[model samples]
Target: MSTPVYEKVALLGLGLIAGSIAWACRRDDVAGEIRGYARSAESRDKTRKLGFCDVVCDSAVEAVQDADLVVLAVPVGAMGPLAREIAPHLKPGCTVTDVGSVKRTVIEEVAPHIPEGVHFVPAHPMAGTEHSGPDAGFASLYDNRWCLIVPTPGTPEADVARLEAFWHRLGANTERMEADHHDLVCAVVSHIPHLIAYTMVGVADDLSKVSEKEVIKFSAAGFRDFTRIAASDPTMWRDVFLTNKEATIEMLGRFTEELFALQRAIRTGDGEQLHAYFTRTRAIRRGIL
Candidate 1:
């Protein structure tokens, strides 16, 4: 058999993304040994009981002791602290990656602490469900998804290609982009949509009293989908919005402008204008599919 892509891989967090990575890497034999660390004892116990890692470390530093690849799968807000904690323990020449949703702030927060000789390849796997925690993960989450690799200027070409191949083996289609650009695009496509879903669902909940339980009883699949997205781990989404502030704010600004226009169209009974706008959005969805 060919050698495994990574002899030893360490995962910083053991939530959905990290658990999915462990499952995928093991299933595909991408890494020989998987070491995992979680801050909470409960999480660490779950990681061990789930058999997600070859060895479970008590601390992030111990997790990266000899890992050739270290993936930080924590919330975006925790990236800096985790990076600082693991920097001293990362083996030289190791490739440290992340499965964060946002890129710009992560690069700034996590990159500085990476020691010399260690390579940092910031990546965002454009995949995941509304689920959180290890039990909610599956090996196929990354399958057929786009994994964006945002590389710094000085990263070695070979290392970049190797990491790209790693994600490919995990069943992801890989693309490279600038960190800032990745944040901007994700904020528009994923972040703002999630925010809107949460708001709409919350509004429905608030109106449930007037609806006399009809809203909950008669909710359709469309609203159900919104509830799923809105129900995603609050802490993770909170960190995402906080860490990727500029992009989220910019997208929110644009979203508010369109929302006002939509409200105006409704008040004025501008059916033609509304129809054209909806048609345009439908085309975009069709393109995505």
Candidate 2:
């Protein structure tokens, strides 16, 4: 067998992303040992029962002690405090990375708390289901997915390369990007879409003219998919929007303008305009396929 990328790895949150990372690392034998910690006893218990990590610690301090790589997989809003709490405990030369969707705020919040010798490399793995919690993780969750490594200025190149290699071993394609650019790209691709999903679901819920039973019973594939996206962990999504507000607002503004154009087309009975718009979107979907 090949040598492990990191001899010891610590996962700061035992939720879906953290659990999946632990599982994937173990599956690939990329880490000699994996330690995990969760804020809730229930989540900790679940993680222990699932056997994702070699050791499950009750506190963040315990989990991170002496670990070479520490992963913060908690919600974006929780990263700052967690970083501060673990800063003193992190082993010298250890590398710390996060899986938060928003990059700019995480970098700003987490960079300061990192100790001088410790490396802080912020990462965002563009992979997950609407499902969450420890039990929702699977070894293949990140397989073939894109993992963006957003490095701030002055970040060590060696540390960034090591983290990229680790992600590659976990079956993900890795790319380096600036934090602000990563935030903007994520807002366009992920944050805005999630907000739209939540809004569509909310609109359906408020349509009193459509009975609740009918809404559920007669739901189409499109509406069902929206519901799935909207069912994502509320805490994570809440923090994502809050942390990536500027980019999200910019995307939302563009989305509103396009929506107005579509509404106008429909109101004016412009079948030609509707056809052209849908045709363009359909081609985009095909490109994705």
Candidate 3:
């Protein structure tokens, strides 16, 4: 067998991202031994049964000890406390990273807890279905996806490059970005869109005349897509909005202005304005395609 990138890797949370990482590492020979920990006993038990990690430890500190790479896959809000809990046990020179969507808040919360010799590289893997949890992950989840590495100003270039290579081995295209810029880009591409999906779904639910059965049965592709996005893990999204408040709120403000303009066009029955706006938006979709 070929040599592994890291001899040992510790996964601090065994949810979809971590579980998928373990699976991909095993499939690609990325790490020699993988250790995992989950806050919930049930999650630990499930991971053990699934056999993703070489060892399933009882605590975060135990899992991370002596590991070359440690990934904090917990929710955004929980990162700081988890960092503090595991800092004392992290091996010197071991690289620590996270899979949090919001980077600036994560850096503020996690950076201070990292010990002197260890490295902290915050990353966001732009992949995942609405489903979460250990069972929701698969080895191919990250294939063709983009993993953005948001390194701080003082971060070592070698460490950033190593982490970028690691993500590449996991089948993702890697790119480096600044933390604040990453948060703003994600707010426009992901966070605000999810909020809008949730709102539209909620509006559908609030319409008394539209029975729940009818809503489900008569759903078009657009509404169906909205429901799929609205089904994302609530705790994760709540922390995302709270932690990335400035960017998310800014995107929401812009979204509201555009929505009001569209509403006015509809109220006034301005067919030309509606057609032009829609044509321009449709061209944007074509650009994506």
Candidate 4:
């Protein structure tokens, strides 16, 4: 058997992402020991019972104590305070990383709290499901998914490489990206899509012409997929949009322009334009396949 990527890995949140990380790390022997902590006693209890963590601590500070790699897997808005709380407790040479999708905001929030000798490398695992909580995690959640690593300036190359190696051990493909570019790319690909999904679901909910029962009873595959995306953990998504406002709004504006063009095509019965537009989009889907 190969050596673990981290001797001690600490996860500061017990939600889906963190739980899945623990599960994946254990599955691949990525870490020699996994310790976890959640804000709520109930989540701590659940994590303890789940047994994915070798030791489940009640506090973030305790969990990060002497940990070689500490992962802040909480919502973006919560990372700052959590970083401050655990800063003094992190070992001098240990590395601290986060799984928040909004990279620029998270770097702004969590970077100052990092100690002089410690490394701060932010990463986002581009993988998850609509379900959340400890029960929602599985060992294969991150398999073959991209995990973007955003290395802060002045962070040593060795430290960044170590974090990339750790994620690879968790079965994720790793790539280094600039923080601003990371947020913008994620906004275009993830944040805006989720926002649109939530909006569509809300429109259906408020469409009094269609009864809620009917909406649920006759959900097409498209609408059902929208519902799935919109069903993601509300707190997490809320933090994502709020922290990633600039990029999200920019993308939303572009999406609005495209929507308007489609509306015009439909109203004027421009079948040729519509066909051309859909054919281009169909190529995108085929490329993804």
For residues 1-289, could you state the per-residue lDDT of candidate 4 as single tens digits?
A: 6799899999998989999999988887899999999998999999989999999997888899889999999889999999999998989999999999899999999999998999999999999899889888999988899999999999999999999998888899998899889989999889999999999999999997999999889999989976688989999999999999999999999999999999999999999999999999999989984
Instruction: Supply candidate 2's per-residue lDDT for 143.
Output: 95
Candidate 1: how many backbone clashes?
Answer: 0
What is the lDDT of every predicted structure here?
Answer: 0.90, 0.92, 0.92, 0.92
Backbone clash tally for model 4? Answer: 0
TM-score of 4: 0.98
Better of 1 and 3 by lDDT: 3
lDDT agreement of model 2 with the native: 0.92
Indicate the residue-level lDDT of 195 in model 4.
Answer: 92
Alpha-carbon shift of residue 22 in model 2 (angstroms): 0.8
Q: Identify the superior model by TM-score, candidate 1 or candidate 2.
A: 2
For each candidate in turn, give its C-alpha RMSD to the true structure in angstroms. Answer: 1.4, 0.8, 0.9, 0.8
List residue ranges in candidate 4 displaced over 4 A. Answer: none
Q: Model 3: residues >4 Å from true position, as ranges?
A: none
